[model samples]
Target: MLRFASLGSGSKGNATLIESGVNDKDTRILLDCGFSTKEVEGRLEKLGRTAESLTAIVITHEHSDHVSGAGRLSRKYNIPVWLTVGTSHACRDNDFYETHFINSHADFEIEALNLHPFPVPHDAREPCQFVFSDGASRLGVVTDLGYYTPHIISHLDKLDSLLLECNYDERMLLNGTYPHSLKKRVHGDKGHLDNKHASELLKKLDLNQLKNIVGMHVSEKNNTEEYASNALCEGLGCEQNAVSLASQAEGFSWREM
Candidate 1:
């Protein structure tokens, strides 16, 4: 069987571990490394894993919350890292670890997982999200995104599971306490996915094959699990509980199609 879990996910840090294997082969990959090396190890230990269990690390962007610990982890564990050329340039000057680059637009395979890194509109040197498959079920992870592009919707159609961002509630953000500048950044074209916009994006996707839908990257002050899940449920025509929220502490549990 193929399964995955998040070590943690949020504004502070983010990491996802995916496992696929049966019989003679097993592969464990970390999607991002936002935590410090020891912190990542602790998180992994919480999930019954360790640093040596990971086959490689893949980064989505250069944001500190996504790449902060990536460099250190790779160096400590001597693991290969995959990212985009632009992302490489952004990190290269920093003497982090042994790294490799991939075209964000290309599709590649690693063991039993088919990996696809698609570009997204986020304020970074080069940011992309991922789609992973074990030849049967597909898991699409889209977070830290600004707006929903048609390409994203089309690519995410019929996914078995999705980890989509629902960063903030528009109303809360508009009326909340953030500075005017930060607020504008969060609401801008490359800011983040607001709850309402996330809901609208869900409406455009084909959820026929969807079994688990995760609302990720929620803002602590501007959003709530209740609000995000309810909005996505409504948009996807699913029950409230049918939609899950990936918390800052524990992202979510492993789910099957």
Candidate 2:
């Protein structure tokens, strides 16, 4: 079985825990480690896991909120970190357990899980998203991208589950307290996906095989759960409650595919 959960999500910090396989052969991959090492340990304890149990850590970019705890966790547990070369260099520190450079368009594996990385438009150096498979089910995670493209759609097609970003509401972002430059950065082409854009991307996907949808990277200041849920559900043609959201605090429980 392939199951995934988030330790936390949002600008403050983020970590995604995905597990596959059974018993002694299980493979646990962390997509991003954006918290303190101790904080990650505490959160993992909530899900009955430990940093020592992780198989690897895959970083999407060098953004602080997405890589704050990566080096420490990898060093403490002796797990490998996989990311593009640009992303690796952009990071301020290099004190990690081990670092593996990956191609944005390539596919790789770590025991039981296969990963496909696709380039994304973000302000960071060489940002990308991920899709994971255990040979039976596929989970696509797309966050921090400013917009979607046909190339992205092609990769996310036929996903069993997706964690898409719904960073802000259009009006709220324009009218919120963020400074002009900050607001522009968050709303620009290399910024984050707003509710409407994320919803539009969902509408273009093939959801015939979709079993789960989770809204990720929501802005606590410029967006609300109700607004995001309503927008995404409208595209999925499902009830608002059917789409679960990852919170900045508790994230969400694991869901199997």
Candidate 3:
């Protein structure tokens, strides 16, 4: 069996837990450690997990909200960390327990799980997302992309589940209090996805086998759970409750695949 959950998601912090296989093949991978090591441990406790159970921590980028506690978490737990060479360089000062430089275009294995890392156009150094498989199922996660590309679309196609960014509502973002430059960056090609475009991207994907669809990393200032979830629901041609929303605090519970 394969399943996943979120420790937290949004601007304040971000982390995801993916677990696959069973018994000796059980592989637990933490996708990002955006919060402090202490906070991550507490959150995992709520989900019935501990740092020692983790097989590895795979970093998406070096942004504070994506990588802030990765090193400390790895060091405390004696878990290996895998990240792109450029992202590792950006975090050179961090003292990790173990480090494995990865390539954006490569596929790798961590015990029972297979991970396909792909580059994304986020502003952070060597940002990327991942597609995970446990032989029988596939799960795609994309949170920090600036914009969607054909290459990205290809990776996300035909998945069993997806955790996608619904960072902002375009109008709300444009009208919010962020400065003009900051606003541009959030909506730019190297920033994040607004509800409208996120919905559009969902429509382009093949969702016949999709069991779960979550709109993650929503903006507290620029979006509402209703707006973000509704947009995703519309694209998927499902009711509002069919779409799950991940908030900065109290992220949704585990969903199995």
Candidate 4:
């Protein structure tokens, strides 16, 4: 069996726990460690797990909200960290227990889980998203990206599950109180994915085997769960309940494939 869960997701912090295999030999991997070590431990406990149970921590980039506790967690638990060369340079200060440099276009394995990292356009040091598989089931996680590109669409073709970003609503973003510069940055091509853009991208993907669709990294100041769900539902031609939202406080529970 293959299953995944999110500890939390937002601009403040983000972490995902993915497990592959069953019984005593399951392999667990944390996709990102954006929160403090103590906070992460608490969240892991919520899922009935501990930091020591993780086999590896895979970082998408060097952004503070994505890598803040990765080094500390790995060091404390003696877990290896996998990231790109650029991300390594950007996080030179963090002391990792073991570091494995991964290529953006390469496929790597962590026990029963297979990971494929693909580059994305984000304002960070070589940021990328991932597609994971446990031989039979595929799960794609695409977040913290600016605009959707053809390459991204191609990479996310068919999957058993998808966690896609629906960062903001254009109307709320334009009418909100954020400074002009910050607003521009948030809506820029190298910023985050707005609801409409995310919806359009979903419409172009192949979702024949899709069992779940999650809207993630929503902007608290500029987006609403209703809007995000409605947008993605429109694209998928499904009900609002079909697409779940990952929140800042209580991340969604585990879903299996």
| lDDT tens digits by residue: candidate 3, 1-257 | 88899999999999999999757547999998899988998999999888899999999999888889998889888999999889988974457899998889989999889999999999888989999998899999999888899999999999999999999999999999999999999999999988888899999998899999899999999999899998999889898888898878877788889
State how far residue 56 of model 1 sits from its true place (Å).
Answer: 0.8
Q: Show the colliding residue pairs in model 4.
A: none
Candidate 2, after superposition: displacement of residue 92 in Å?
1.1
lDDT of each residue in 175-195, candidate 1, tens digit only:
999999989999998989998
Question: Candidates' TM-scores?
Answer: 0.95, 0.99, 0.97, 0.98
Clashing pairs in 1: none
> For model 4, how does the per-residue alpha-carbon lDDT over 1-257 read when each residue is reduced to its tens digit?
78999999898999998999877568999998999999999999998889989999999988887899998899889999999888989985457999998999999999999999999998888888999998998999987988988999999999999999999999999999999998998899889999999999989999999998899999899999999999999889898887899888867789999
What RMSD does model 2 have? Answer: 0.7
Q: Give the candidate order by descending TM-score.
A: 2, 4, 3, 1
Candidate 3: C-alpha RMSD to true structure equals: 1.1
Model 1 has an lDDT value of 0.85
Judging by lDDT against the true structure, name the best candidate: 2
Error at 170, model 2, angstroms: 0.7
TM-score of 4: 0.98
Ten-residue region with minimum lDDT total, candidate 1: 91-100
* RMSD in Å for model 1: 1.6
